[model samples]
Target chain A: MRIEANTRRGQPVTIYVDGTPVQAYTGETVAPALLASGRRAWRVTPWGEPRGLFCGIGICFDCTATVNGVPYVRTCQTPVAEGMVIETERPLERDQ
Target chain B: MNPEPVHTDIAVVGAGPAGLSAAVAAAVAGASVTVIDAYSQPGGQYFRQPNPAVDPDPQEPRPRAGRELRHKAEAAGVRFLNRTVVWGAFEDLRLAAYREDTAQAIELQADAIILAPGTYERVAAFPGWTLPGVITTGAAQTLLKEQRLLPGQRIILAGTGPLQLVTAAALVKAGAQVVAVLEGASPGEAILRQPGQTLAAVWGQSTRLKEGWQSWRTLKKAGVPYHRGWGIIAAEGKDSLQAVRIARLDRQWRPIPGTERRLEADTLCLNYGFTPATELAQLFGVQLHWRPAQGGFVPRRDEQMQTNVPGLFIVGDGAGVGGAELAMVEGQIAGLAAARQVLGDSTLTRRIEALQPALRREQRFQQFYARLFTPGPGLDELAAGDTPICRCEGVSKATIVQTIHAGADTMHAVKAVTRCGMGNCQGRVCGPLVAAILAQETGQSPERVGQFRARTPIFPVPLTAFTVLTTEGAESAESRN
Candidate 1:
């Protein structure tokens, strides 16, 4: 559950996560928005372990998720857009 | 398929305080300046401004030092390429950067290049550190400062340096319950024993001293226990962070046998200070020297922030782990020096001369802080054999030790054999840990273990972005055949 820390609000937008509509803000990154919605696990490893948002920066890439059909997009770096589709546990093909 | 190289008088690789200052100074000196940063915003980590859409109090006046520098640089006609990642440094000081918005690779050639990539938080490997709720202090601050998001309901800020206190205060203000602050150094020793040095360090920096005092007062008023000479030995969690095992440390920072205590915490913010981000400098073949006091291997820079390479300059945390204040001073000096070289302007010398005193004072404070917050020896022993040291590859400490025992003497060799530093991070997170492990096992100095040689594409770029280069190479090979 993401706590409301302040009173400032951006234009509320809806982004689909795993085909489920998740509410997000216009200026927030996808990672924080997902965390705010209580979806902490962005990706599941091949070993079935869940990982998400380790560094909170682009460097770690742990927060990577499939966004708008593109796999391994760093959710922390990618800002949320209205109607953006995000998938959490899509397996990255070797060629991709 | 090669992209046309963008030419600039001065190319600043980072938009942090150091890079921003350098770009502004050079632009003010009538030189064409281009500043590039991976972040969409101008401020580096230290001045991470909030995104208006996410920030509840978007109009709240936070620190504007970084914003002011960025604005000044922009006003001086300095070009800023935000959300661009510099992936490689090539011959003649050329840089290859990937633009995130366009997914295109661009080359930049500059008369002079300033590298100020800043630093990354150094985290010691402990059990359960890879858990979901375990994060670096910088990560916590980024969440709070940028997103106004608290890490967890119950958080424990454990680390050394003034950053812990500052982060704890921020977390408290943000309404997170800061259970306690575990500092590795003895507060009395750091404050009382070195009273003269502490006073001298803060002598000219009243604002900084006041900030520190205010943070301390905040924590004190909150009734949060600030344990001195204590450190986290392990974090106990199954899926995410539920608790952390902390212990009292001796002078050498070794944990006392019977002093272990477990604290219930939903989040564990681990920060042992920062390590210089030297991938670009290392890629450029700039010389690096190990200065343990300055937080490990850093690029060697002269007084003017110029590296051994004539046109290559490094400042900020990229050169060393000096804070933003020193980074600004160094950046100004470097910018002035670079401008003098490229524009043949000697008038900038007076400005550079004027910054020397402030630079010296900041340096003095940095040295004192470094000495006071040196990571304890016990931190080296925190990673058990099964603990994951390289989070990128999920390589365990045992695997690294096994690789070492199997005759992989150097870090490069170990990486080659175990793929410890070959993950998405490209050794940024595991490089220091592996080096420390190698040093401990082989009895070789960290310098002797050596850092991983950074290859082209320092940051991971999309494979599709490289299709043009690959096609060109294929075409050339077909023509030769």
Candidate 2:
């Protein structure tokens, strides 16, 4: 979670993750918001194992989630947008 | 939809210390310079910027330095293409990129190219490493540095090198309860054994020593345990990290049998070292030589940082595992050298020659760094049977070992048969891990196993990006969206 009292941040933005609204700021990426909102498993693999932000950078695709109908977008690289719906659980269906 | 390829006298593939400095030098030398970086902003990881809202950090100097470097580049007529992915490098210095915001496919035809692609943290696989809360030391540092966020309430920094102390100190300052910092190698012992060489390596690097001292001071104030000759064996948890199992290690880093201890923590930050980002340079037909201590398979380059391929130069950690200071010096030299070639002017030769001393000093530090921090060979045997090696495909150590034993000895064969490197990450994350697995199983050195053959479109590109360029047509060149 952001150290709200200590740090200055962009304007507040709300994005839905698995149908739950997550509060974020304008300048931050989706990965931080996702982790801050208490969602660690950004994506559930085909084996049903949980994976989160292994490499916060874009190199690892482990943090990919469906963002506003775009499947497999890296949350670590993607910025948080207002009212964006991020679907993580039913990821396989979106890809198909 | 600029159908006409973007033309530039020099094209740089990163915006880190090396690339930024190179861009500034070349542009200042009367050459048109364009740099492309995957990040939304300049200052690749080493000089990674914090949120613009955050005040300049007193402990971290790189972010402020990065801002100045970017400004210097801009003032020198260096154009930056941020948030652009260079997915492919083709013949005759051509590059294919996708602009994220505009959804457009772009191409670059350059006179000369400098690659400062940088390094990615190398992680050794252990049981539960695939858990939700286990992340690399670099990842955690990115979280704290860039986003002003922490991965968990209580974090354990387990890695080799000064990065462990640095990350722990950062975590502590950010209000997280840092449980401990477990250094894989015995650097304290290293300093004691080679005090003279240590002084030589660290002689010119006062700021580095000061930074290490500051981190130690911060950890000491918080009463955080800084364990040398120790490291984590595995991360243990249900869905996320609940604890880390650690143990004492011998000189080779093999965990001692009776020294097992489990420390409760919500997050586990792990790193053995790093791998040079040689994929892009390799795809550009640059020859690679195995330099394990330099983070494996770095591109071969001349003193001027020019690769075997004419007009192509690679610098910084991308060429080898040298730190940011070395990268900047090399960047300047390469920039001056490349600009001299393109503009048909030898006037910049003196400026390039002057940077040799700084470059040599940084090289000395780099060697000292490798000797002190590079973990023992025992790290290669970290993965257990069920431990996942291929993070992209979820391929396990058991499957990989079996594949190697079944005569899939080569890196390519193992990848092909088991789908090890065939995933969204395109083998970047799992390539090193699988190579180690293959080597352990076959009793061959990782160098003998070779690397995964990189192809065009090294990074995954969305299909829709292509349609935008095609639909816009060549006549509507320079369409900004």
Candidate 3:
């Protein structure tokens, strides 16, 4: 069952990783593009855990990455658009 | 602030068959492993009911194999962290997880990670699907396995799949008076149509099904009727499920005249199929194929269970639903493959060959089951105007249909307008039902609606749980260096 395939390859987009600029495709997520681009690590170490994606579905929040300075953007759900810079810093929630 | 850089060679999330197998294999190869899970036990959802203290029926006999596996995992030198909720994963091997009732973070730096998160039940839509007494077959099993509780004494196990029979057998064994096992598919159709696949499956699950069939036969001997060509038409109840109306169907499965029957029961068990729990895989950016066989949108992994992403692997139901034994083999294969990858061993051809037969057998068995229990007729049509498609926010079928007619072409538009999938349960309950409805309304194929668009914040986090973000916060300087 072929659904609508409105996608084409090599459509460039910008993804910021921990505030660093990384080029990506227009219809991909930050984490997979990061790994595909040879960036194995998404964040710095604190506890000795190998984290990437686990439950590819959203039930488990294992794939949450920061996007455009917004914290907890699920990398799996966030598709890339041109010039969309994503941030991957560990967010510290301030008391409101 | 408590800041520390906890480092490890491998961080295995989930303590189920896949996670335990991966952790044990990696640890055997000298990697420090930390296995975390929401449950306080090693077995994720499938191998549930391990702790005998929480036995399904204290008076009834227990299964010996489960007890053995729990013992083996406990002695395998794998660090098991139970009751741990891994809320999110940050880059650099850092994980934001809460444990022991405290919202502290845990950072894991590891060389490799294996994802063995299991699958959850997919409940499709129909009338009274959201009523108090209508629960998933998996949820019923979980209640029995985890807390040793039955929903009611007289229950109607109405749905497709081998689980309908299995759950009936379990309920009967647990002392619930199973009135009838109404399967959506015809029993003898496969014997006439797909004899080859049918025979192969019968051979593989002979022992297991024989046990189930024996229990079912025992229930039948005790006067419990098992109907094959029947489907539920209506679930009648005021505040809960009080009675269920069932009807016999013709070949194409429309209801036959004068065949309608009503049975009094408190609980109705329903499960159309399962969906691959792929949120984390999507997060990791692993490539996914819309595999109806794998329960939809599973990561594209090779025979060795390696995902498209390097050093990141997935197995078990999260990879795709292949039942318990297949998951175990896949887990072992993924563990071995990950270990060999870490060790730089190029000779994995022989290892993969040894694992091929079991995988093939499991796939064949699953294919047989998938063909056997196709959804019953009139279920999707049973959706009344007021029937709730989205249980989380209580969106009705009329609302979704009207929105689609009003120019909501994609699932994204429908979700945005109705807020159906934007609930705490994370659309595990409503997503598939809505997709099917959209497909039916738009004259689109189920596969077309199968590509349901996912928006951000896929998980529903209660607003009260978060204290509004402020700029001032303590730094994790000590943990950083």
Candidate 4:
């Protein structure tokens, strides 16, 4: 569970995670917003092990998720856009 | 057709304190400057500003110094290309970058380039380090500084360096239960080893000393236990971090036989120190020298911050792991020198000369800190055969050992055989560890084992971003013929 540390600024926006509508604040990255909503594991490795936010910066690329149809978008670096869709799981090949 | 490359008097890669300072100084010296950074915003990592759109508390004050320098740079007409990753540095000081917003490839040619790519946190591998809640201390700070988010309810700040103290204080202030702050170096030994130097360093840097004292007091008042000469041997967990195994270390940093203890913590923040992001420097064919004090292999720079390769300058943590203050000073010297080199400005010489004393003082402090927190021999033994050394590839210690035993002697050969350093991170995360392992196996120094040879496209860029560039390449080739 994520703790709210401070009052978030900006208008509340809805971002879809696995097609589920989740509330997110503007100006926040997808990773923190997902974490705040208690969704920590963003991706399963090719080995099928869960991983998330090892390095919060873009360096590690551990927090990558499918955002707006782009797979492997670094959630930590990509700011949340209104109505953005983020998928924790990699879409199947046919979906591409 | 290939678009004409954008030319600038000075191109600064990275917008951190060092890059910002350099850009501002260069622009002020009447050189047209362009600062390119991968982050969406300026300030690099040290002065990371919250995203205004998503920041819940916009009123929270950001690092004023970095912000001020950024503004000054903007006012001085420094062009900033944010969210732009310079993927390759090629012949004639040309740079290829991918702009995130435009989703296009851009080329830049600069008379002089200053690389301040900064550093990334170093992690000594141990069992369960790949767990979800196991993160680097810098990662914790990034969450707190950028999002005001705490890593976990209960956190253990483990590793060496003054950063651990600062991180613990920040965690406590952010309402996280900091279970303990572990330091590999004994405070008494650190001071005793260089009494006169330590005293002089503290005396010379009164402000830093005061800040350190304040952080100490804050941690003490919070009743957080601070353990010196102790380190995390391993983290224990299933899917996420549940606890960390800690042990007291001897002078060589080897764990004491009877000092093993386990503490429950959802989050284990580990950071031995930092490794300089020198891929760009290496790609530019600039010479690198291993100065254990400077973290690892760093680009060799002269007093003016110019590398052995002409027109390529390096500063900040990219040059070496000197902290922000030294980085800023070095940035100024490099900026002024670059501007003078390009613009034939003689007046900038005095300004560069003026910063020497402050630079020397900061260097003295850096040397002291490097000695105090250099990862000890015990850290080398943390990763067992099963421990994952390369997280990106899931290459284990056993795999690396097997590869080495199969006659892969150099880092390059091992990388070729085991794919150790060929990850999304470009080996930034595991290069040092692999080098250390190779050194241990061969009974040679890490420098002799060597670093991975940097190749073009230092960072991964989207294939789609290159479509236009591919056609442009053909056109350019035809035109050249």
DockQ of each: 0.58, 0.73, 0.02, 0.59
- For B1-481, candidate 1 gives per-residue lDDT tens digits of 4555789999999998899989988999999999999998888988788885544233433346667777799899999998999877766667778889878777778999999999888888988888888888887888888877787888998889889999998888778899999999875677787888889987788777787898899999999999989999888776677899999999888899999999999888888988888888877777789898888888887889898888899999878887888998999999999999999988878888999999999999889878888886678888999988877778999999999999999988999999998988888888888998999999998778888877667898876555434222222111221
Q: Residue B306 of model 2: what lDDT?
A: 98
Q: Which candidate number has the best DockQ?
A: 2
What is the C-alpha lDDT profile of model 3 across B1-481, one tens digit per residue? Answer: 3355466656777777777766766666545667777665566765654223323222222234444454555566567667565554444444445553243445454566788878777664656555545666765665454434455657888777777777787777666788787877786787678787688886767766776677777767667788988878778775556788889876555668899999998778886667877766665567888777668778899878887777778888788877777777887787777767776665654775797887788878877767666664356666788877775466889999999999997888898899877765566667777877887889987667754543223345434222322223322211222
Q: What tens-digit string does per-residue lDDT give for candidate 2 at B1-481?
A: 5667788999999999999999999999999999999998899988998875445442457888988889999999999998988877766676778888767788887899999899888887888888988888888988898898988988888879888898899889888899989998877777798899988888789889999999999999999999988888888889888998999988988999999999998888888888988877877677789998899998888889998889999998889988889999999999999999999998899998999999989999999889888887677787888888888788999998988888998998998899998998888888888887778778888789878988656788987545423322222111211
Q: In terms of lDDT, which candidate is stronger, 3 or 4?
A: 4
Q: Which stretches of candidate 1 lie over 4 Å from their true place?
A: A1-5, A90-96, B54-62, B467-481
TM-score of chain A of each: 0.87, 0.89, 0.66, 0.85
Top TM-score model: 2
In model 2, residue pairs whose N, Cα or C atoms come closer than 3 Å (at least 3 residues apart or on different chains), thus clashing, are none
Q: Candidate 4: global Cα-lDDT? A: 0.84
Candidate 4 regions exceeding 4 Å error are A1-6, A90-96, B54-62, B467-481
Residue B117's lDDT in candidate 4: 95
Overlapping backbone residue pairs in candidate 4 total 7
Q: Candidate 4's residue-wise lDDT over B1-481, tens digit each?
A: 2467889999999999899999999999999999999987799988888655554234433466667788899999999999999887767787888998779788888999999999989888888888888888888888887777887878999888888998899788778899999998876776987799888776578767776787798899999999998999998877788889999998888999998999999888989999898888877777889888998888878899998878889999888998998999999999999999999989889999999998998898898888888878778888989988888888999999999988999999999999888988878888888998999988888889888877767788987555434333332211121
- Candidate 3, which segments miss by more than 4 Å at Cα? A1-96, B1-5, B50-64, B92-94, B100-102, B250-254, B345-352, B376-378, B451-481
What is candidate 3's CA lDDT for residue B414?
A: 91
The DockQ of predicted model 4 stands at: 0.59
- DockQ-superior candidate, 2 or 4: 2
**Model 3 Cα shift for residue B78 (angstroms):** 1.3
Candidate 1 TM-score over all chains jointly: 0.94
Once model 1 is optimally superposed onto the true structure by TM-score, how far is the C-alpha of residue A61 displaced, in angstroms? Answer: 1.3
